[model samples]
Target: MKQSGNSKQFAKKDGEACPRGRPREFDTDTVLTSASQVFWNHGYHATSIDDLCKATGLLRGSLYGVFGDKHGIMLAALDHYAEGSVARLAERLNAPVPAEEALRNALLHYARVACALTGERSCFITNTTLEMQPGDEELRTRVAAIQRRMATLLAASVIRGQASGAFNSTLDEKAVGDFLLCVMQGLRVLGRVAHKEDALIGIVDVAMRALV
Candidate 1:
């Protein structure tokens, strides 16, 4: 005879599976994705182990076992975010579309995502730079390296556009790239302040025009 199993065993808790086992092998990718979102929504200082567990649906022991500590998890999450952001930007830069149009669309997309956040306005790297202690040289270096890489990517795109005559060749590549980065960060700040979408769009339009 077939028997019915206990419903409580398969019940969902907080929208996550209430699975039982040796806690299941950790999926690094999924954990990082969830952790990144949590870090994005709540700055490093504000996010706790409990917050991480809730976001990843991992128990406290599982989290510690896989990540070692909060800092380890944060570092992994930051790496994941950085890779995904660069990949998305690269897709736009590599597109066959006109360079000017590609750059503009990329910037606009970034603004939309930034503003979508409920309370935060800036990118996680930017936020971390502002909040992390200066004495934490490792984190500072990591953030700086990531920022430099981003600027380099932007500069390369600008250089390509200039060479193809799609962008203003007269503008300095380094300066233009730096300017764009600042514009993106500024939009994130404005987002935190709950600025209107039109206001951010206006800024993007002006910045894009300057590049072309």
Candidate 2:
């Protein structure tokens, strides 16, 4: 993720016709990655400006100047996370394998990641919705859109599996896709509490049983 710029320098000479002063030397992608982790670990309301400043290694003035506000930085981080997530989903769904198996693998991978021993840094999108839903209309809308994109990918996989006789053709593909999306989000919540590995695996196995 190379940030485009003719210069990587930030500390410029004063009154040199450079109005923005220093011009932000750090990579935008790098800042978002670090900031996203802070927000993911600490809820949206819990994270403070000072927290972001420390996480991104930017002064308060620089962060505010670059991002406008905490909300702006958060919005960018959320978009970045959701984009990466959906792209990964697309890659898994487009794998050179049985559609049904690929779908199962995708679900299992999320489950494993969610249920990992040090699962504090869960999906930022999921964490956002859980933390800010019902009140944060902007973020709620964004998360819903992201979920729809996820559901669309899952439904395509389901449709493919049905066409190949790998899934139950009688079931409505969209319903099944939405169901899987709901289950995966539930798994993320359960991931925070479930201590045993078999418990998470069993939940995933049963969730996949819907594909029959």
Candidate 3:
């Protein structure tokens, strides 16, 4: 959508005082959070510029100025969600608790979020990844890289568990990490159709067996 007529340009000399009552600057993180929720609720292909504008409270001009286009907004939202996910995983996995317990807690955390009352159930990353077309190599690659980052964090935890005699030493650490990643993604999908929190937690419980 094109910008509304209300959008105006401002010009000032270098030392001029700032215009009074200027609109507050947009918080990019806040906008991305709202946009990410819109994308999660409606897959990337289905979310329109109007939807984003409504969710983020930004005019079309401001949205385009900040993100360039619909695809740009989605990309920014995906990166925002992925960065937060990685940070949370690192915090949980790097804690002083036993590796198995730490991993279980991590899985349980996803379970809780999946079961939350939010109308949308799918994860922002998982939903966006699944919606990607075959020709979207750049998008596919970006998704792969993010998954690898999370998997690496999981693998490191598994390796630590192996070293400490807490996890199955016979299992390949990387493979177990990949498996956990799959389980987490599966929880996101299951969360879409299942409302019962116990169902998701049960899956986490079953997934923990891999560490044993």
Best by TM-score: 2
Which digits, one per residue and each the tens of the lDDT, describe model 1 over residues 155-189?
A: 88899889999889899999888888888777777
Per lDDT, the best of the predicted structures is: 3
Tell me each candidate's TM-score: 0.80, 0.86, 0.83
Pairs in clash, predicted candidate 2: 10-22
Where does candidate 3 clash, by residue pair?
Answer: none
- Candidate 3 lDDT at 2 equals 27
| Cα lDDT of model 3 by residue, 15-94, tens digit | 22224625335778889999998988888988999999899986676677667789889888888889998999999998
Residue 10 displacement in candidate 1 (angstroms): 24
What TM-score would candidate 2 get against the native?
A: 0.86
Off by over 4 Å in 3: 1-25, 117-119
lDDT ranking, best first: 3, 2, 1
Single out the weakest 10-residue window by summed lDDT for candidate 2. 6-15
